[model samples]
Target: MRLFLPLVITFICGIVMILHFFIPHRPISTIGDGLTDWYMIVASAAIFLGAANLVQVHVHRINTKARNWKYSPVVLIGFIAMMATGLLWGVEETLPFDYMFQTMIVPMGATMFSLLAFFVASAAFRAFRASNWRATLLLASAFIVMLGRVPIGGMIWKQIPIISEWMMQVPNMAGQRAVMIGAALGVVATSLRMIFGIERSYLGGAD
Candidate 1:
């Protein structure tokens, strides 16, 4: 019964959603839109569940006087400060809470992305290793494209920009379109299998 119910619902819901793309009737179209909006609302509620879980795990460690209990107070305080600010003020504008979040959260998020610069540089170095003809060609193309995008490269070699643009528009776009088509087919296949109960990874591991 646990497995049976979800499969039935998935089949019904996926079919209804796909049909909505073609159906033009106002009532059916509205039902489709309403269901999609309800999905977003449901997702919003789950955000609380995630926050509750975080507090539960961290608070338990703090209560038990775990090794890093010192950090828990900071976490709790930060949470409370933001919550108080947002609850008292509003998210629509530069309320104190929103401002704090914008300044602090945005920079921290940006720093996280900045961390990727190092990894990408490292990966590019590793990815360019010329072990084979194909690898050598790819590395050469990547170097040309990267340099072509920069002003120094344009000054050094005026022809690279044209070469890179042709590669990007022709071969790269063709490969991207092929991959997208394959991905679409793969998604449809997986969804259909799930709807038919052929896939059950959602159910936990064996007992």
Candidate 2:
């Protein structure tokens, strides 16, 4: 009954939402908007549940003295501190929440990305080996793009920047559009499968 009810609701909602786009009738549009608001409420609840689960898991790890458990308390402290700050001060620009986000979170994120750059460069070096014609072409394109971005590139060859720009606008854009279309089609297929109850994995073994 639990699985059946959800599947029915999913099918009905999906149909209504799809129709709402084409029909454009007042009541159908109102229903679609109301469903969207309901979705927001459900999403907020899910986030709250997820946060609670995170804290629970961390606290259990700390109590058990598990491996690398020392970090669990830090996670808890940061979570609580952020929650308290937001609740008390409001997340205004002058508030502690905003200050911590700007000073602490932003720098940490930037540092993480900086570290990732080295790993990405290592991977690119491995991938750009010129064993095959395709690999050679890719290596050349990457070299041109990287060189074009710096002052030394223009010093070596004035046309490097123009070639790099053309490659990005033409080949890069075509590849990106192809990838996006494939992803959109996949999403549509998955949504349809769910609406038809063919994808019951989401129902927690209800299959």
Which candidate tops TM-score? 1
Per residue, candidate 2 scores C-alpha lDDT tens digits across 58-105 of 999999999999999999999999999999999999799999999999
Alpha carbon lDDT of each predicted model: 0.86, 0.93
Q: What TM-score fits each model?
A: 0.86, 0.86
Q: Which candidate is the best by lDDT?
A: 2
Clash number for candidate 1: 0
Alpha-carbon error at 151 in model 1, in Å?
3.2
To one decimal, what is the Cα RMSD in angstroms of model 1 from the true structure?
2.5
lDDT of 1 by residue, 1-207 (tens): 777777788777877787789996887688789889989999999999989987897899899999989998888888888888888886766689879988999899999999999999999888899999999999999988888888887798899888888888899999999999999999999888776677777765122
Off by more than 4 A, model 2: 204-207
